[model samples]
Target: MAEPKNEEFLDDIEDAEAQAYAEEMEEIDDEALELDQLRAERDQLRDRFMRALADAENARKRSDRDRREAENYGGSKLSRDMLPVYDNMKRAIETITDEQKEANSALIEGIELTMRELLSVFKKHGIEIIAPEVGDRFDPQHHQAMFEAPVPGTKAGDIIQVAAEGFMLHDRLLRPAQVGVSSTPAS
Candidate 1:
């Protein structure tokens, strides 16, 4: 009877030990699952932050490009309006002949000085004249065809005459040179 009682007590101790070990294992498994969930949440947040940063950088670059363009081309409208004044000055100078200059030396000199000053101002503002000479190849980008004519010794698409000179503000054309293009082949 004593031996059986001792055996029963030992069996009860073993059962208690097994149950405690199983409960400990369940707690460990729950902790590991919670750790994995936290890692996934952290990765998602990091991805969102990276995307937002890229968007901000792109917006900044776009704004800088817009500002530069505005700075470079802001005076285009005013420059365009002043072109007719320059044209009139040039025409006045062209109409004066040697006889006229000799007859009115003082007046001619004053007109010449004023024209020079205007041209200097134009140069300072990055304004350039697009003057295509006769016999030169006609470029549509800088020249506008006012008329086409057949002329001897000129190939088709050659510049026959320039009716009015064009103006350019930097690389942008304020006005295209009005020209007559040759329609006949070279004789």
Candidate 2:
């Protein structure tokens, strides 16, 4: 009877030890799973942070480019509006006869001075005239052909006449020169 009782006690001790070991393994597995979840959360946060940083950088660059363009082209509209005034002034000067200039010398001088000042202002602001001479090669970029005519001693595409001069605002064409182009020489 004492031996049976001792055997039963030892079996009970063995069962208790096995149950404790199983519990420890379950705790370890739970800790490992929690660690994996934390690592995945950290990776997702890092990816979002990188994407947000890139978007902010791109927006900043775009704003800088827009500011530069606005500074350069802000006066385009006003400049375009003032071109007709320049044209009228030039026409007035051209139409004046020598007799008219002599009779109204003082008035003519004042007009000439005003024209010179206006031209000075235009030059300071990067406005320039595109005046092509007769016999020059016709350039489609600066000259607009109003008419084409066959002429003696002139090659095709030669500038035979300039009806109106062109103007440029910086590198851009404010107006194209109105011109007559020569066709093939008459047979």
Candidate 3:
């Protein structure tokens, strides 16, 4: 009976040790799972942060391009509106007769001064005049042909008449010069 009791006690201790080892292994597995979850969360957050940073940089570049375009072309409409005033003044100057100029010398001088001031302002604002002569070759990019006529002693595509002068605003054509082209046949 004493020997049987000793064997039972040893069996109970072995069972307890096996149970403790199983619990320790379970705890280690739980810790490993928790660490894996933390790593996955950190990777997701890093990816999102990198994408947001790229989007912000693209927006800044787009806005800078818009600002530059606005600065360069802000006064385009106002400059275009001022063209007819220049044409009318030029016509007035052209129609003045010699007798009229002699009689109204002071008035003519005032008009001339005003015209000069207007041209000076145009030059300051990057406006240029496209003055094509009657005998020069016609250019379709700068001249708009109003009519085609076979004028004597003129070659084909020659500029016969210039009805209205052209204007340019900083390398862009505001108005093309209205002209008449010669359609002469070759001799």
Candidate 4:
């Protein structure tokens, strides 16, 4: 009977040890779950940081491009305004009477040379004249129609007259060419 009692006590001790081991394992599992949650959060933060850095870089690039464009086109308006002066000087030379020019050949030559030099300065600064020649096809991108006229032999949509010469600075249009375009003949 005593031996039977001892055996039962030993069985009880073995059951208690197994329960303790199971509880320890459960605690370890809980710790592992918490660690996994922390790692997931860290990964999300890292991903967000990288995305923000990329967005900032893109914004910086856009700002740089915009600044360069602004700087390049800054003088366009003033340059356009100055074009009329150049045109007036040219007209003064061209419209002078033949008698006046013949009487003052040296003075006329000096004025002509000055006009050429002024044009050279314009070219140096990337300013260009938009004087389309006669019989040239009218381009709406550069020409502004002031009137429509029918000529004896000229085709429709052709530039018959330039009211005011246009100009461009770099690739930007400073002014559209004021032009008289030919009209379609009356049927």
Candidate 5:
């Protein structure tokens, strides 16, 4: 009877140990699940932070582009309004005769000086003159055809004459050069 009772006592001890091991394994499994959840949350937060940072950088770039464009093209309207004054001054200087210059030398000198000053201001402000001469290849991008005429010794699309000079403000064309295009057939 003593031997049988000792065996039963050993069996109880084994059951208790097995139960303890199973509980410990369950606890480890729960901890591992919680760790996986934490890692997933951290990854999500990192992704969101990276996206917000990219959006901020894009907004900054757009603002810089807007500022640059405003600085370059803000005064375009005023610059265009002043073009006629330059044109008139240029025409007056070109049409002046030698006799007129001799009779009014001081006045002519003043006019010439004023025209030069205007041209200097235009140059300083990124305004450029587009003067197209005759017999050059006609480019529609820079020249506006005022009239088309066929003339001897000229190919089709050849420039027959220049009616008026053009102006450019920076990379933009303020006015196209008025020109006459030849309608002669390409031979």
Candidate 6:
């Protein structure tokens, strides 16, 4: 009878200990789950922060590029407006009669001086002229051919005459050179 009582007490103690251990394991598992949730939230927040930072950087770069372009092309309209005056000055110098030039050296000199001053003004404002002389090869990038003339002593596709001079403002083409090209003579 005494041995039976001792066995029952031992069985009860073992059951109580097993229950306590199971409760402790459950608490530990709950803590681990909480920790995992916190880590996942932290990772998501970090990714969002990185994306926002990248967007800000991209916007800053875009703004800087826009500012630079504005600075580069600020005077485009003014330069374009002044092109006709320059062209007229160039025409005046080119169309003078040789006899008039000889008879009135002072008038010719004054015209030449005015043309030079106009060219200087163009250089100051970032406007440049494109005029290819005769015998120069015709380039489609800067020259537009009005017609092809059959001539001798010149290669085909060579520039024979410049009908209208071209102009540019800060590496941008304002006008295309109207030119006459040469073709092979008829055999």
**Which candidate number would show the highest TM-score if scored against the true structure?**
5
Q: Which 10 consecutive residues of model 2 have the lowest summed lDDT? A: 68-77
Q: Assess candidate 2 and give its lDDT.
A: 0.90
C-alpha lDDT values of all predictions: 0.89, 0.90, 0.90, 0.88, 0.90, 0.87
Candidate 1 matches the true fold with a TM-score of 0.76
Worst 10 residues of 5 by lDDT: 67-76
Estimate the TM-score for candidate 6.
0.73
Provide the lowest-lDDT 10-residue window in model 3: 68-77
TM-score of each: 0.76, 0.76, 0.71, 0.77, 0.80, 0.73
- Tell me how far candidate 1 lies from the true structure as C-alpha RMSD in angstroms: 3.4
The order by descending TM-score is 5, 4, 1, 2, 6, 3
71-164, model 6: which lDDT tens digit per residue? Answer: 7667778777877887787788888898989999998999898888878987886778898899899998889999998888888999999898
- Model 2 agreement with the true structure over 1-187: per-residue lDDT tens digits: 9998899999988988988988999999999999999999999999999999999999999999899767655667877788788889889999999999989999999998999998898788777889999999999999999999999999999999999888888888888999999999789
Which candidate, 1 or 6, has the higher lDDT? Answer: 1
Q: How do the residues 1-187 of candidate 1 rate in per-residue lDDT, one tens digit apiece?
A: 9988899998888888888888888889898898899999999999999999999999999999889767666788988888888888889989999999999999999998988898898788788999899988999899999999899888899999999999888889999999999997645
Which pairs clash in model 3? none
Instruction: Summarize candidate 3's per-residue lDDT along 27-87 as a digit string, tens digits.
Output: 9889899889999999999999999999999999999988975665566688779888989
lDDT of 4 by residue, 67-116 (tens): 97777677787787788888899789879899989999999999999999
Residue 39 in model 1: lDDT: 91
RMSD of each: 3.4, 3.2, 3.8, 3.3, 3.0, 3.9
Give candidate 4's error at residue 31 in angstroms: 3.0
Q: What is model 2's C-alpha RMSD?
A: 3.2
Candidate 1 lDDT for residue 79: 82
